[model samples]
Structure formats: structure tokens, C-alpha cells
Target: MQKREALEFDILFVGAGPANLASAIHLQRLLKRHNATAANPLEPSIAVIEKGRYAGAHLLSGALLDPRALDEFFPDYRAKGCPVEATVSKESIWFLQSKRKFAVPFIPEPFSNKNSLIVSLSRLGAWMAEQAENEGVQLFDNTAASAPFMENGKLTGIITDDKGIGKDGNSKTNFEPGLLLKAKAIVIGEGSDGSLTRQLSMHFPSISAAQRYETGVKETWEIPEERITAGEVHHTFGFPLESDVYGGGWLYAFSPTLVSVGCISSVGHDSPVCDPHLNLQRFKLHPLIANILKSGKMVESGARTITSGGLDAMPPLCGPGYLLTGESAGMVNMQRHKGIHLAMKSGTIAAETLFEALLHNDFSTGRLKSSEERFRNSWAWEELHAARNYRKAFDKGLYSGLVQAGLQLGIPGLSLKTTQLTLPGFTETPSFNPKKKKIALPVIPEFRADGMRTFSKERSLFSSGVMHEENQPCHLVIKREDIAEICLKKCKKEFANPCQHFCPAGVYEITTEPVPALKLNPSNCLHCKTCEIADPYGIITWTTPEGGGGPGYKLS
Candidate 1:
């Protein structure tokens, strides 16, 4: 590799997600206040780099925004033109059987959303980016951070993704190497299971226990205006998932005619077929959900992973000259099924600590450590602490997990007690024995898309607007050289080629026409990273391809 051109900045934030955007905006405000009273004014260059074609191009969420962080970030967020679909006015919880449903008599306090606002997360990211830019922060979309740049055993900056490389591993006519971005202070706010975060963890100390994740598949629907009222929120458990699986379904109306529906499946299941996309399709077949969307049109669809490990699984927040915020730091409160507010709050706290470092002209690990201290003292820490054991509670089974959750709510301090189940998701998956005559596949209900009320994965993916350059190198890398042997001999007999079933975008296919082999269609990738987390062998590595290559999630 040749030495690339370099760009220098006082501060650089990676991944233009809510956390980094909030950090940039808040830092500018702090600088403005300090300049007003200081003898010497400080003007430092700050920039944010995003991998998507635009700030919100790859963003997806079933978002219900708590006003706590918004109130502090912008006192009058509504007046300042923050994008909100609707204010939550009604809520309910339901337990569904194959064809019927039963509503819970009382909603749990943690599940309540009476006053929260429904939103399109992608749109919200766009709005936040505009605000940050207005504060004089530079925004660079279509630039993926390949890895953290290290110097003398310390974090320095990032290396952007290279371009114009052929699939054959040769430089193209327009080949251009990645740039070296050096910064005094760097903040990483990449969402769940980011590649850069994984690279950093290898060099730095992380939680002793493996982090947990849940794959969520979502779709936006245009239904009859009279079927459901705006601001209606509904959550359901049972029906689609098995007794041993921990997951559920959610439905929220952005308007009388537009609704967001999705399903989340825990990756910690003991079966190889924990497919979230298939689970969501099964959820729509229930009478309650089916009747509401019988005449609906599918508008958009996408998938993403949630960092559900909570406070205990969080890595150290700061290293030398670098800081981690948002989902990258595991700032979510899974009990409430909310994180956007917490992520934004973490960014604001990081801004405060970085602002102080700027004033003193010091960017050392000791100075960056204050950001972690401030986060611990903030309300975000308190909320996460209360829900620390929420996700792990479900490791036993749905009914048993529910009992544990109920007990936690009823008894003070009971939630803090950790369970003995500490195995990571992949290790829990059981293997099938080919020698056994009774070897059976995991049970997943059969579904056929009507192209109206229910949809196939291909139809849903079309709505996501996903694309990538076909001539570029495949981003899905199989770490082992014996992928074919594993997929054909061992995986075929023991696990039944799970990648073909787990990938939401149909990126992996097992073809038997010419010969029994593993095939990949990397261009169909939604950038969800599901294959990396759920693969039993942990052989798949999802890397960034060319810049601006991914789903264009607009109304998600």
C-alpha cells in the first residue's frame, strides 16, 4: 500500500449517527460559550465522516423518542423543526396464539409510551445533521471509516475505505487508495457491531463476557386510514416465536394510514434458524395484525441489530485520544426498548469532556477518561443500571423470563442480581447429527407472500433501495479458506447451511446445479451485519465495500 493523502482536524467523529451528530452540535455550543468569556478565542476544525450516501441513507429504527435528551439538546426541539411522526396517545400489549390474541390487562411501566413521539429515525438523522452543519461542523457522507489509525500503541484517527478496486484483487483504472485522517481527538459512534469497533476491541480491553445482539427486521406499510388511528402503539409476544425463543413484535402508526411493523429475534437462541425476517412474516399472519393491514401496501423495509447487552457488556468508553459513544458503548436500556435518547445523551456528555480538553490543549487518555466519569454520573447511567439484567433475563425462555421480569418490577434491587447464563449467542446454538436417523430441522412456520397483506423477502428488499457496485470486491469475507468444505461436509450435515436461512437480504445461497457449493451475492447486502453475529462458526466478516454502497433508507 502506498502512502495516501492526509487530512488533519482538531476533532473527528466517525459514523454520522445520532450520538456523533449530537456530540458535534453540543461541542460547538460549548466552544461558543467559552469564547464569549475567555481572553483568547479557540477555533478548532471538527468533522464527521459517514459511510452512507447521506447522513440518514443507512439508518433504520422503530423509534419512539423520549423527550429527556431532546429537552436538553435543544430546549425547543419541536419549535426548532425536529421531525416527529406523531405523539403517542394510546398503547397496549398483547399475547398472541396462532390465530387469536389476548390483551394484557395492565401495561408494564417500562413498556409505556404515552407521551413519547413516533418518528422515522432516518429522517431524524437528516434533521440532526442539518443542525450540526448550522453549528459550523463539517459533514462528510459517503466516506466509510475502514479502521482506527494507531501510532505508538495509541489511537490517533481513522483510515477511510478504498475505492476503484476490482473484484479480482487488482487496482482499476480509476483506483484510489483510502485517505489518512489524523485528529487530536476522535469519537466513534458507529451503531451496533461496527467493524471499526471490533478492530479496536482486539487491541483494547473489553467486557469479560461476550456482548449480545438482537436482529430486528422492519417494514413501513400504507394501510386504510380508518383501520387504525394515528399515535396508536401496540406490542405483542408469542405466536411467531417458540417457547424457548426470546423476541416479540411491535406496531406503531406514524399516521392514520402509515404504520411501522417489525419483529426482533434474539441471536442467543439455541437453534440455527433464528431468522428475524421469517419471524416477522409469520407475525403478520395473526388475525389481529392481518386485519389491520389486509389492504395495506408495503412502502419500505430494512433490518438492523440492537446492542442489547446493556451496562454490563459495555467496553471502556475512552482510550488514548479516542472515545466511544451510543450503541458502540452499549448505552441502550433494553427494558424500555429505547436507545436513541440515551445515545444522544452519551454524545452530549462526550462533548462536554472533549470541550474541556480543547480549552487546555490536551488530548490524552487521562483527559478523555472524564467523559466516562460524566456518563456514569448522568441520568443515562441510572436508567441503564436499572435495566442491566433485562436482556439476559430472557435467556431461560419466554415464560420464565417474563416471571423474572415481573419479579424484578415488584421487588426493589432484585433486577441487579446477575444470572449464571453468560454464554455468547453463537456458542449456544446446538448442532445436528447427520448419523442420527431422526435428525430434524428447526421448526419455522411456512409462509407465502400474497404481495398485499404479506410479502416475500425480495419484495420487501426492493422497497429498501439497497445497491452496491457489482465490480467491487465482495465485502462478505469468509475467514477460513475451507468455506466450501465446511459448508458442504460439516455445516451441511450438522447445521444445514444456516447462513442461507439467516441472512435477511438473501446474500448467501447454497447452489446445487453445477455442484453443491456456497454462493454469495454481496450486492444484495442491506449492511445489517446479521450474518456476522449469528453464524455458528463465526467465519463471516462483513466489511465496507465502496463508499455510498448500501440501502437508501428514507422513510424507515
Candidate 2:
């Protein structure tokens, strides 16, 4: 083993996504203000380490920015050359039938993104990295933080993933041991299903409910000029999905030629065999969506899961020496279908709490808990409180969920009656239905990709620009071969893998002609981590790939 490098800081952040950048930037500002006013000024060191090759390589989202939090983060954002694709000017919602659609004139308050910006989250994240660096925050890209360091159920810091190791479980010539990053306070902002956050949970049982999630698959394309009006955000439900399935489709035409088309499906739905990626593909086949996307040229495609557990899913804000923020902390509010601003807000609150802790030279859980009060007192709390039951209402399916949503909207204090989800232990809720399991085995019609608007998974994965060192250990691991057998038994077939369905990247497939077993194409992964979240058997574990071995955001 090589002698690993060590680093120390007053504050350390893992994952350089929106939350990390936002919080670091806010902290810097606070530090600057304090230094200017205080007789005894102090300069605190701040550091951020990211798993992505660059800041935005792995950042993907439907990306409708509710600028409320962004405005607070950078009051003069537009002046800072922030990338705002277009200010939403028009919005529409529709309920679709197999061959028909009806426009609903009523735009929900959440979708009423009047001045909200339709922008690429990748662009926004990259921009924040630049801004954070300008504020003197140390930024390290292509560095993966593997796990948190916990001592007696308290976080002391993090340990980064080992580098330059070979597939044979031995160190190579260029081997480097993982770095130990110790800090007075640690901020976890690794986005959805963060690995370190999961690691910490092992030492300290989850303080809040485990998250319920919805997976989204999207394709970016340059649509025909005449068909789209820039800044138009259109959403639709029904069609493509069975009555029992909870899912929906969206189209964000942010420019005359640039548009995003996607589908989101509940991970805990009753249909275990239903394929979200296939559902997204089937969504484009609908006449209503087919018309707009038919003549477009494909640009990029990817998939990711969003937190839907709302306020109920959020874990405790702080541990002894650590605090959780962003999706890692379950800040995404389901009702509004927007978490970009919420992520920023959570980070801002964490920053304020950390600032106070810094001044007092205290890093205990009690001191950090102040951030939770500020968060609950902020508007984020009110919005989240109302949406607390949004995802839980979906337990009965889409129609019922919508009805409950309406009642919650129209009736005062309705959500106060919401109950906590009591999920199964050892394992959790299964996203698929056993009755429909075999029947839902993804009978994708002989639909061919036209290469313009429609493309195959291989083509889409290529567009995502993901690259992995094939000879290295597979980051996507199957811990229990017995789990595979159980999955096949559930599907009632030999060598049948459920992973092939939920993975939008088509990384897992069961090949019968050769030896009748699963095959992994790890290089094509989009880094969505859906396999880790939705696998019914709870056997698939997503570890950090070789540094910079995932998708590269191109728009390269």
C-alpha cells in the first residue's frame, strides 16, 4: 500500500453539484462579510471534492429552475453571465388517452413558472463551480469521496476512493491510496443516493425515512423550427402507462429548435417488470408527443432518479461533525416537481448554520441543528410541509394521487393528517407488481429509431459520452448471485435480469444464446444510479467508478 495523502480544512464538501457549490459560495460571502466587520478577522479554508471529471459531467435534470433560491444565492445572477436558456412565457398541462389528448387551461401553481428559467442544470452547476472558485474555495474535480469517517456514531470526515487499482484486486504501478479528508465540519452534497451518505447510514441508522423515488429518462433534441415556441413548458399524464402505473411525460421547448422530452415513473410502483426506459420510448410513440419530436435531431440523452418522499423523506440535518444537504438529504419537494432551487436553499441554510458554528468553534450536532430550525422557518419549510403528503398519496396510484393532491390544495391543513410510510425491513418496498411481472416483461414493439428523433439505447448512451476503463473492476457490482436467481424466479425464467429494465443506459442484459446469464456493459452507464435504487433484490451496489469514468456532459 502506498502512503496516502492527507488534507485538512475548516469545512469540507463532498460532491461538487449544486448544493456543494451553492453552500460554499454562500459561506465564502459570509466569511468575507465577517472579516470586513470584525476586529479579529479569520480566514477559513473551504474545500470541495467531486466524483465527476468536471463539475457538470454527471449533472442531468428536467432542469426547470424556480429561481427563488438562485436569486437569494446570487442576487445579481444575470449580471454574472448565468446561463438562462429562456424565461418561461407559456405553460400547458394535459391528460392524454391512447389516441387523443385534451388541453387543460388550468395551470397548477407549481407549473406556473412565470419568470422561472428553463436552463441546463449542467450549465448552472459548472457556472457555480467557477463562482465558488472565484470566492477562493478549493475545488477538486475527478476526485471521488468513497465513504465518511465515523467515530462512535459521529462523522469526523471522509475517505476518498482508492485510485489506480487493478481488476485483480491488487495495486498497479501508479497506485495511490485513498486520501483522508478531515475537517472541523463536513457537508454531504453528493446528490441522489450518495454513496458516502449510504456509508454513513451503516454506522448511524437513518434518522429519517428512506426516500421514495421516481426515475426520469430524457432525450434532448433540436426540434423543427416552426413547431416550437421558446420557453414553453408542457406536461402530460396518462397514456403509455397502464392504469396501475404512476408516471407522466414532459416537454420543455426552451428554444425554437432545442427541446427536452422525457418520462418519469415511480420506482415503487406495482409493476416490477415495467421498464421505465421503455416507457419513455413508448411515450414518444404517442401521437401527441410523436408529432413534436418526430422531426428533431437528437442531441443528448440520460436518466436520473429524484426524491419524491418530500418533507417526510428528509433525514436529520446534522450529525456530530457533519451536515447533509441537497438530494443526499432529501430536499426535493415532489409537489412542485422542482428541486433545483430547493437544493440551493438547503445549501444556503447549511452555510448559515456552519457560519455560526465556525464562529463559536463548535462542531457538535446540537450546534449544527440550528440550520434545521432556520430551514423549517424558511419558505422551503412551508412549501415542503404542504407537499409532505404528495408522494405518499401516490401509494394508491396516479389518479388517486391527483385527487389527493387536489384535496390538499383546496382544503386547509389536509396534509397534517399524512402518515409516515412504514416500509419493510432488511429489504424495502418493491417498485413492481408480481401479478403483472411476467406480463409487463417489456414487449417493446418492433419500433426502429429513425436516427433523427428516435434512437436506440446504444445510440443514446453514445450521445451521453460516458467512458470507463474496461479492464478496471466493475463499479456496478452484483453482490449476491442468489439475488439473480430470485429475480429470475420472480420473472419465472432462467437467467432473466430485472436490472436490464430499469437501467436506461442498457448496461445490464441477459444473453441466452451464449451461456444464459447477465452481461454488463459498464462503459455505457449514464451514472443515474437507478440500478442501485430500484433493484427488487437489493443486491446491486453502485460504487465510484474510476475517477472520471462516467458520462461527460456534452451540449462535450
Candidate 3:
């Protein structure tokens, strides 16, 4: 590859989500504070890179905002326009069966959210971007940081993905190589399952400890005015998932007629039939949920993978010239199903540490290591430490997890006694063997999209506004030609090509017209990365797509 265009900054933050946005805002203030006395044009420069076509196009979350970090970030933020759609006023928990539901008499203390507000995280990211720009941070949308640029066994900066290419591995008419963005200090806040984050963590042996993941699918509905009580919050467990599977479902009435229904299926499932997409379809047909969604019109839907492991298994925060924050560093509090606040807090700490390093003319691990210690002392750290064993406790079964979690709630010290389950999600299931296992399902896993209430995968993908250039090379790579043959054999025998069942968007299919093979529809990709994590044969690798190609998620 020939040399490409390059840009330099004093500090560069990747991803335009909450964490990087918060860091850029804080760093702007620090830079301005330092240059208050003398007007130096050579002072620190801050920039943020985002893959979205716009500020909010690639962000998603169930998204109830805890105002702790926001309160600290901007005390007078209320004066500015806020994106909170509804303040959570009513909350409840329930256990549901196929035909009935029963509310838990008492809601757990940790699950309480009296002051939180329901929000579209994408909207929040746009608002934060506005705040960052006001503080003089440069924002670059339609640009994606693909991989870390390493030199001399240390980090230097990042390389953006190439702009144009074709399926034949040759440049197109609009061919353009990736650009190099250099910075003295870098911060990666690119949500869970990010491409660059994966490279940084996986390639580096000392930094790659966190590996647990969960697939989350969500849909927005426009119901009748009388159907929903605004600001209502509800969470569920037990019915949709088996006793051995670690997962749950959620519903929240964020507006007068808009409700979000979703399901989360953890990756360390014991059944070969642990299909998350089909599981959510079954969950919606349940009487309890079906009643709420009756006569409702589907608005939008999307899916994303979550990083569930916290402090105990998280990747290292600092290496040489860069610091990792947000879900990329495993900052989520799995017990509460919350992470935006913790991610923002990590950004604040990263900002403080980087500013100090820049001021002192040092970017080595020796100086950047302080950021990790600073995070360890923050409230976000305290919360994660207390709930560190929450997700891992479920490895044995739901009962063991529930018991351990219940005990830790009343007595925080019990967390020390909680055992850590370090099982990697990819190694949990077995490959297809017709004689040994039987596939279980609610509906045929191969249901076609109807574009109506019972929408098919392709129609559901349309709801997400997903797009990719037809001429671009396939992003989902299969290691060998025989792998498709194996999947085809399993499809014929028993498994029915599990990728079609697992992908929230219909990206994979088995074809027999020309020849029996596993076909890929990359244009329908939701960018969820579930196929990369859950493939039984361990052959798929999802590389970065074109610079500006993906679902344009506005309200996810």
C-alpha cells in the first residue's frame, strides 16, 4: 500500500459515543485552562472520529440514563436542551410463563431507578457531540478507525478503513486508500465488539482478558394512545430462556405511544438450540407480551452485542500511547444492565490522565497507568467491583446466579465470596451431530419476512435503514471453502444452518440452486457481530466494511 493522507492532533479519541464525547469535552476545557495566560497556536488539538454518516447513526442501547456522570460533566445542562424522552416514574419486575404473568412482590434495591430517564442513546450522542464542538473539539463523521497503527513494539495511532474496493479484490473507479491519524495520546471508546477494539485486545496477549458477550435485540412499536402509561418500566426473566441459559427480557414505555421491547441472550448457553433471534420471536408471541403489543404497528428494530464482563475480566486500560474506555474496556455494570454512566466516567478519568501526560511531556505506560488507578478509585469502579461476580455467577445455572446475586445485594461483602466463571462464550456449544442432539424451536427458524407484524429478518433489517455499496468486498470472511460444505451438510442433517437463525438481520442463507452452499447477504448486516462470536465452526471473521456503510440507526 502506498502512503496515504495523514492528520495529526495532540489527542485523538475514537468513536463519537458518550465516552469519547465526554473525554473530548473535558480535554477542551483543560487545554483552554492551560493556555489562558499565553496565546500559543501550537497548543493541544483534540479530535473525535465516528463511523456514522451523522452524529447519531451508529449508536444503540436500551438506554435509561443515570444522571450521576452527566451531573458532574455539566451542572447546568438542564438549561440546554436535553434528550431524555421520559423520566422513569413507575418500575416493576415479573416472572412470566407461556400463558400467564406474575409480578414480584418486591423489586430488588439495585434495580431501583427513581431518578433515571428513558432515552435514545443515539440522541444523547448527538447532544454530547454538540457540547464537544462548542468546546472546540473537531468532529469527523463518515470516517471509521479500522486498526491501531503500531510501530517499534508500541502504539502510534490508527488507520481509517479504505474508501472504495470491489468483491474481486481490486480498486474501483473511486478507489482511495485509508488515512493515518496520528496523536500523542489516543482514547478508544468505540462500544462493545468494535473492530479496532478487537484487534487491540486480541493481538496483544497481555491486554486481552475480557471475552464474555451477549446478543441484544430490540424493536420499537407505535401503540394506541390508551395502551401505554408513559414512563412505565418493566423487566422480565425465566420464561423466554431455559434454566441453563443466562438471559432476560425488557419492556419500557418511554412515551405516550412508543414502547421498546427487547431480549438479551447471553453467550454461554448450554443448548445448541440457543438461538437469540428465534427466542425473541417466541417471547413476543407469549400472552403477556402479545397483549401489550396487540394492534401496535412496528416502528423500527436493531440488534447489538454487549460486553458483559466487568473489572475482573476486562482488558487492560493502558498500553503505550493509548487508553481504552467505555465498553471496549468492559466498564458495564451487568447486574443493573446499565453502562453509559460508567463509560462516561471512564472517559473523564482518561481525559484527566491524558491532559496530565501531555502537560508533562510523557506518553509511556508509566504515565498512562495512572488512568487505570484513577478509574479504580472512582464511583464507577466501586459499582463494577461490587457487581463483578454478577454475570459470571450464572455459569452453573440461573438458581445459583440468583442466589449469589440475592445474597450480595443485602450484604455487599458477600461479593468477595462469589466465584468467577471464566468460560469463553464461543467454546460453550457443540457442532452439529444428528444422532446426538435434536433442534428445538417455537416457529420454523426459516420463516420468511412478511413486512407486517410478523416481520422477517430482511424486513426487520429494512427497519434499521441498513445499507452497503453493492460493489464493495464482503466484510464477513469465511476461512475455507469446505466450511460452507460442512454447514450445508449440517443444514441437511439437523442444524438447518444456525447462522440464519442466530443473525438478527438475515445475512446468511443456504442455497441449493446452482450448488449447495452457504450464501452471504452482507448488505443486510446490522453490524451486530453475533455471527463472528457464535459461529460453531469458528471460521468467520468480520472485518471493517467501507468507511460509511452500516445501519443508520436514529432511535436505537
Q: Candidate 1 vs candidate 2: which has greater lDDT?
A: 1
- Each candidate's number of clashing pairs is 0, 6, 1
- Pull out the clashing pairs in model 3: 449-456
lDDT of 1 by residue, 1-556 (tens): 5799999999999989989999999999999998999999989999999999999998899988898887897787788799999999899999999988899999878778878999999999999999999999999999999978899878787999999999998999999999999999899998998888888876785522367788899999999879888899999999898877778999999999999999988764235576788899889888988988887888999999988888877888888878898988888888888999999999999999899899899998899899888988999988888777777777778887788788777762254345545644533232334455644768566667778777777887899999898999999998445586676777777667878778888999889988887889998999998888877666678888888999999988
> How many angstroms is residue 288 displaced in model 1 relative to the true structure, after the best TM-score fit?
1.3
Q: Which stretches of candidate 3 lie over 4 Å from their true place?
A: 37-42, 268-272, 413-419, 424-452, 482-486, 489-496
Q: For model 2, how does the per-residue alpha-carbon lDDT over 1-556 read when each residue is reduced to its tens digit?
A: 4466778899999888888899999999999999998998868899999888899988888778989998887898899998888888788888888888999878867546788889888888899999999999999888888777766777887888787888888878887788988898999998887878877777767643567677888878887788878898988889777656667888887698998888888664323455677777778878878898876677888888887777866888787788888898888876768898888999999999999988998888899989889997999888888777776666666777777777787762264334565532113434444454344244435556666656678888877878887667888877555445664454336214557776888988777675566678887887787887867656677888877778887441
Task: Write the residue-wise lDDT of candidate 3 on 274-383 in tens digits.
Answer: 56776677778777677788888888888888888777768788887788889888888888899998888988899899888877788888999999789878898889
Off by over 4 Å in 2: 1-3, 412-418, 421-447, 487-496
- Candidate number of the best lDDT: 1
Who is ahead in TM-score, 1 or 2? 1
Per-candidate TM-scores read 0.96, 0.93, 0.93
Better structure of 2 and 3 per lDDT: 3
Instruction: At residue 104, give the lDDT of candidate 2.
Output: 82
Query: Which 10 consecutive residues of model 3 have the lowest summed lDDT?
Result: 425-434
